[model samples]
Target: MKAFILDHYKKKGPLRFGDMSEPEVGDDDVLVQVHAAGLNLLDSKIRDGEFKPILPYRPPFILGHDMAGTVIRVGSNVRRFKLGDEIYARPRDGRIGTFAQLIAVNEADVALKPSNLSMEEAASIPLVALTAWQVLVEAAALKKGQKILIHAGSGGVGSFAIQLAKHLGATVATTTSTANIELVKSLGADVIIDYKKQDFETLLTGYDVVLNSLDGDTLQKSLNILKPGGKLISISGPPDPDFAREQGLNWFLRQLLRLLSLKIRRKARRHRVTYAFLFMRANGDQLSKIATLIEDGIIRPVMDKIFPFAAVNEALAYIETGRSRGKVVVKMR
Candidate 1:
């Protein structure tokens, strides 16, 4: 099968496109024929070896995280789906390889694609939607009438989060450039902070939660806008000790993570708010609920661009610019 292989980890490294061996499906896995895949900053970070310490994908592996495809075959133990099922997923961290003609995803991570969406649109939802779900819905337990600030409102996760937060009845505020103000507004953001023109900290205060997907500086600033007992969750992170423990790292790595996050954690403590890192996991059940929301028109997919499969490198470059208004997808067919 033709696939893009990462021969080594280098900043702005190019993935080698070539034929590779087919995947061996486990009893709980489904072999999928790739139709489209989504591009994310996480993909670039992994390619640049930023996640080497935690994820540690050795050289010469395929690199991709989000995908929408058709199940061509299901393992004997996979009863939820069968051949010809249209599905989408962010395959579990260790098993991700969606930048290919095919992939074998565990049945537990796969969900039926929303009937209202195309393969490209479906491909864009899993990673970003799951991130928003994990942050606001699962972690924060955001409630109606509460206020939440979401950074990078026009970006993938931010776009999804603004809508989801509004759906959850929280007042949504977000930061973006002038060009994207209307875009975020259409996504149901109640307050728009033009980061280029205004300082969000001056204009906002006493928020229930703040979802940070920006730089360390932005992460630090986010803590101030929240009131006492507010949750400050970051997906771009100096991951906290809890994450290290969840990954079951050794004591050395655990203490290292503690040291890395110590300053921000201390600041959070002083402000009477809680700070934590969010690393989203794959769950078909959550995706199923997200699909229903999509079908019901409560949430819509925000699409930026779709590249041909051959132009995946170009797609990655575009995403790295951090200027895209929404999700960037690579269509395989």
Candidate 2:
């Protein structure tokens, strides 16, 4: 099979396209023929060795997180899906390799694709959509009539979150460039702060939740926007002790994370708001619900571009620019 292989971790290196043997499917896995795959900042970070301490994937591995394709075969235990089923997923962390001609995903991490979407669009949803779903619905438990501020509203996770927050009946506020003001508004953002012209901290207040997906400084600034007893959930972070524990890191790594996040955690406590660092996990059930929203037209994907499979490196470069309005995809079929 032809696949892009990361021979080694380099801060600015590109993946080498090569041939590798097909994957072995487990009893609880499904073998998928790749149709399209999504590009994410996480992919770049992993390639650059940023997640080495935690994720620890050795060199010479395929790299991709989001995918939409057809099930070529299903394991004996996979009763929910079978051959020819259209599916999409962010394969479980240790099992991800969607940037290839085929991948074997654990059945529990795969979901039927939204019937209303194309393979490229479906590929864009799993990672970003799941991030938003985990933050707003699962972690924050956001309620109607409340207000929430989602940073980087034009980005992948931000775009989905703004729409989902509005669907949940919460008033949504978001930060983006002036050029993307209308984009976020169309996604149902009640308040759009042009980051190039205005500061979000000055404009949003008394919010029930603040979803931060920006830099450390931006993460700190987000804490002020939330009201007392509000929640501050950061997907990009100085990982907190809780996240380290969730990943089951060793005592040294756990204490290191605790110390790294100490200042921000203290600040959150001082403001009487709770803080958590969310590292999204794969869940077939959550993706199924997200598929329902897409099929119902409650949430539509906001795509930036789709590159051919041969342009995988180019796709990753585009995402690194931090300029794409939404998700970037690679068509493999």
lDDT of each: 0.95, 0.95
Candidate 1 structure quality by residue, lDDT tens digits, 205-263 = 99999999999999999888999999999999989999999998889999999999999
Error of 2 at 104 (Å): 0.1
- Separately for all candidates shown, the number of backbone clashes (residues 3 or more apart, or on different chains) is 0, 0
Write candidate 2's Cα lDDT for 5-114 as tens digits.
Answer: 99999986999999988999999999999999999999999999999999999989999999999999888898999899999999999888899999999999999999
Q: Please state the error at residue 118 of candidate 2 in Å.
A: 0.3
Candidate 2: residue pairs that collide? none
User: Which TM-score value belongs to model 1?
Assistant: 0.99
lDDT of the structure predicted as candidate 2: 0.95
> In model 1, which runs have C-alpha deviations exceeding 4 angstroms?
none
Error of 1 at 150 (Å): 0.3
